[model samples]
Target: MARYELVKRSVALITLTNPPVNALSSAVRHAIAKSMEHALNDPKVSAVVICGENGRFCGGADIREFAGPLRGPPLVPLLDAIEAGEKPVVAAIEGVALGGGFELALVCHYRIAHFKARLGLPEVTLGILPAAGGTQRLPRLIGIPAALELITTGRHISAQEALKLGIVDQVTEQNACEVAVEFALRAVAKPLSSRRVSMLTTPCPPDLDALLEAVTMQVKKKARGVMAPLACIQAVRAAATMPYSKGIKRESELMATLFNSGQARALQYCFFAQRTAGKWTLPSGAQWNNSKPREIRSAAIIGLGTMGRGIVVSLARVGISVIAVESEKKLLETGKQMVIGMLERDAKRRGVSASLNLLKFTLSLQDLKDVDLVIEAVFEDMALKKRVFQELSKVCRPATLLCTNTSGLDVDALAGVTDRPHLVVGMHFFSPAHVMKLLEVVCGPRSSSETIATAMSLGKRMGKVSVAVGNCPGFVGNRMLKPYLDQATFLLEEGATPEQIDKALEDFGFAMGVFRMSDLAGLDVGWRVRKESGLTGPDVDPKNPPRRRQGRRYCPIPDMVCEQGRFGQKTGRGWYMYDKPGGTNAKPDPLIQNLLEMYRSRYGIQPRNISDQEIIERCLFALANEGFRILEDGIAARPEDIDVIYLFGYGFPRHGGGPMFYSSMVGLERVLERLEHYHQAHPDVPHLEPSPLLKKLVACGSPPVQKWREHIKTMHSHL
Candidate 1:
């Protein structure tokens, strides 16, 4: 819907009137066309100004429309008509002009942007190119190289950057609509031929082919199996080599190729899934909408290790005063210096002064007594955590919230040690908390809705994709990781090398394979967990079979690697050997191959060649199978939450959706059949067995991932 008015007596002002981010829906598109027609036909109209009703210009096309057949006037022809109109049209950009919105601005003869405005063609992020003459017009307005980079990456630019790139004619701090009207009025007396971007020749570089080829390699290397960036590259090439008419047709052809693709569907699903994950709902009917979160002005962090330092930085950067605690004076000083340096570097990159003044490092728990919230980021030992909680209960005020940054411990057990159990929740920030976007708010049985809301709200304030999950060992992301890691280790015992398995997964779109990720994460962490759980070391029964643990087939290869002091990158060795201690580059060591051969010989097991298909099916299917169990257990409210966790926390490829969605994409029937087949072949491996939820879903015709919650009975929900 658009509202049209005559401003300055001669200029027709057409404002898009959709709420929030004025997305171009069918109705809005129809209104835009009609408004432009009237403006062109009106005798009094010398020029026209287009802007959104709210501060936001437009986000993009209404992505909800992508689910159905397109209606109303097609965007390309409508945009072309606007460009061809004899009356000069000016775009007034304020908040954002993305995808179709950015394309809409391109057709206008002039663009005036507010200082805070952001602009980009972000269709490639949804696995499609900018199809509404964007590919053709942008290169003509700016050069081919700049257009190619913006289109392929979907990176947004500020108004200053837009002005520097020549995308906008003027940038002002005043009302963009008013400035645009004045700009249009002045442009009415000038020739329109030069202002029409489509009529301009694209400035192609001399080494166009080489530049395109280099960008192609870069995109392929960065995104792996992604298709949209490559398609975008082809469209940009068309713009550089062909006339506007041909280039526009080529852009449409490229968009058609990507529009209905599976990759596009997965990426689009991910877009919606992130939004759905935030709408957390508890069984008591306390949800995101109803629950009120307390404002956290100041917080305390117990311990100043890697996670603690990052958490301190995260809190401080968001203008929340942070008091970081350590056990000793020496440790406190070390953490203080490290945190300051990290914050300084981060602030430098963001073009802001470091918020170091807000940070306070201390060796006393008494320093945290007055803080609004206290996050325990000490070691993962349960006893150590309980002691810390008990001390906090004695020291802190009754109203202060208590949170744990535990990766995979029982929140209820920790909550039991505190006087304010209802205030205790788990804020599981992934490693390097200052950088990673995920923050799993683990809601214990005793956690109050306000506590959960506050944790979720604080995570959002720190620019995190926070999902509220039910309390369980390892919560949602790490709990499901057990079976996935198990399957990868089992593949090694079956004669598949680490590189082979990793390659199979990497080719499937993972940024890094399991073994490579393990190396980076430090293999000793899991080894310590295994040792404490009595799965390995002296606690294991000597009478128990070496390859068996707790009545299930287990791989002790990781323990063996740890026995050799191959902790991971820190020690320069893990599944693969690094060049030196603290080195990142991993290479397959002959010593590991020899170890594998000896282990196989001692066990009298035959090594068989494994296919990439088997590796992917076994690892990923096992991962999804655990997700099904998590859903049935009520650990995650919906498939979207699980997917979002994997996407943001575990580096799950965006184009593959998440494990739950990927399982649905693979067909539940196929997953169940494969899981059953694997279970039959290895009766000793219980994880290979299909979960009840998977079988139930398969029996019920395997509805889409969004509909999975309906089938799950929440009678035994933990949240």
Candidate 2:
């Protein structure tokens, strides 16, 4: 795990040999401890330089070891021994030094970082504080304020930033190991007392109490119920007030508190879940590692609306030439300017020149004839999409792949319109595609494995967390949204106001409640979808009872709101009122409250009190219930894929895991019972009923979310 040798006849070079990120596994830690001992005991060694073999410094603790018992020398004492060594020890940081790795660098007498290197104490992100003298040493090296920000946020800083903050002694453009070795040679005769960070007094601000209080408030407000940041703040406070010995104890205590916490487990599960989501698989045995993805040098986007414009920016920034199409000349010009401005601003932020020269805007399909792939981002109408695909089949070459940016429309139906049904797939990019990290690669029944692979790879290139999902209405993210949204509206009808319900969900860790999210997303979108489905408006049979559509109970409240031209933020009114059209600040509107009261009176139904618990159970349980059904239906391959979609596409809280994991954490038996109770109470609502998969899992002893795919193996698979 580690290699040691003498260089310059006086300096010992210790290089960590672990491949990839050189995570501090038990073996690697043992190796490091032994190597340090040899360097310190050797009479000829005057100095030591430590670095990773493959340019990357340690990424952090081996998370795989987290589930096992500690088997090697403990990190804290090992790091302390190195810090107290008689020989000067220098850390040569190259690609990254994070978490325990950053802690490793902290204990060294000196640090030299490559200009492109990154460093951070990101233990807080995993629901733990830095336990290896990081909280104590960092506050002493940098001031309390800067240390608090870095430790609390777990944000990585550039080598230059590390230099400015005194985290690293120097940043070099050349090889960091060479620079560190030279630095270690010159430091052999220097006093080591001042070089030891833990010995330095923490730079205290005058208003220490107030500053700590302010940061505490900010953390609480931003993260809500998250525990790690709060613990990090407390650790930093200890470093500011207590001796190093006491401060480090406090840090360890904080880490212990977080290490076993459910929140910590959830965060760690999320970390792995994100990585697992990338390894897509199909029933045909074609998977991520085996399937070959075609190289996309150039692509075309149909329609130049919000989604299309964002798609263009996403492609151009990644060095792929994009041809954006529009039906009208005026719309084409407007989209052209928007795409250019967005690309330029994005480039400015990234410190790179805009790739605007790669973009082509036109009102003709002929411009896309030679493109490698064509993503139709027109309106989410199947007929319109079909027409576009038909046109593309005629315009583009036979080998070109065709993709649709439809959120819920049928991918196979659109495939049927093209000559290449096997090439047609869904690239469902979330709104503001350039910013959102999620892309659902909807694999149609006819979609070839190669086509799916290409879309997934392209999504990765665009900096998206793409999950390959089977073709179905709404795919994974939005398909499950139906029940969730239904439960929220039903609560509103049962006397819970929008604010009350939104408050309950937001307190439950959702960034926004259903109603508030709907307002911002534009209520007209769902309203139009409902109308098109004949659930409301002229298409509905007048013979059917009011508030009842087909066989199940329906909420006409949204339709009524839309009828009044309330289309959410864009119209300055929806479930809540805004200051003006295009405004964001949403306040409860009296008009909505009055409408609800009149609707209740007209139906001769009594309004009842609804508890926050009921709101959460009904809404979230319904969401998870749909996820179980999706799993049973084989639309999603695993619970993790569904969770990833929610995490990246939707704003599911990280600490709670995703809906599927949350359901498992809540205990499947309890979920099934609650769902059964809800179903009995509201017999007219089908969504409240527990799915068979949930019942099966509960009967099978409610295994962990990770084990769910084993049970789902017998079910028919779409991907």
In order, candidate lDDTs are 0.93, 0.93
With candidate 1 superimposed using the best TM-score fit, by how many Å does residue 484's alpha carbon deviate from the native? Answer: 0.4
Candidate 2 per-residue C-alpha lDDT over 549-629 given as tens digits, one digit per residue, 9 for 90 to 100:
989999999899999999998999999999999999999999999999999999987999999999999999999999999
- Models 1 onward score TM values of 0.99, 0.98
The residue-by-residue lDDT of candidate 1 on 86-189, one tens digit each, is 99999999999999999999999999999999999999899999999999999988998899999999999999999999999999999999999888889998
After superposition, the stretches of candidate 2 with alpha carbons farther than 4 Å from their true spots are none
Q: Candidate 1, after superposition: displacement of residue 593 in Å? A: 0.6
Pairs that collide, model 1 = 1-28
Candidate 1: lDDT of 467? 96
> Worst lDDT window (10 residues) for model 2?
62-71
Residue 216 lDDT in model 1?
99
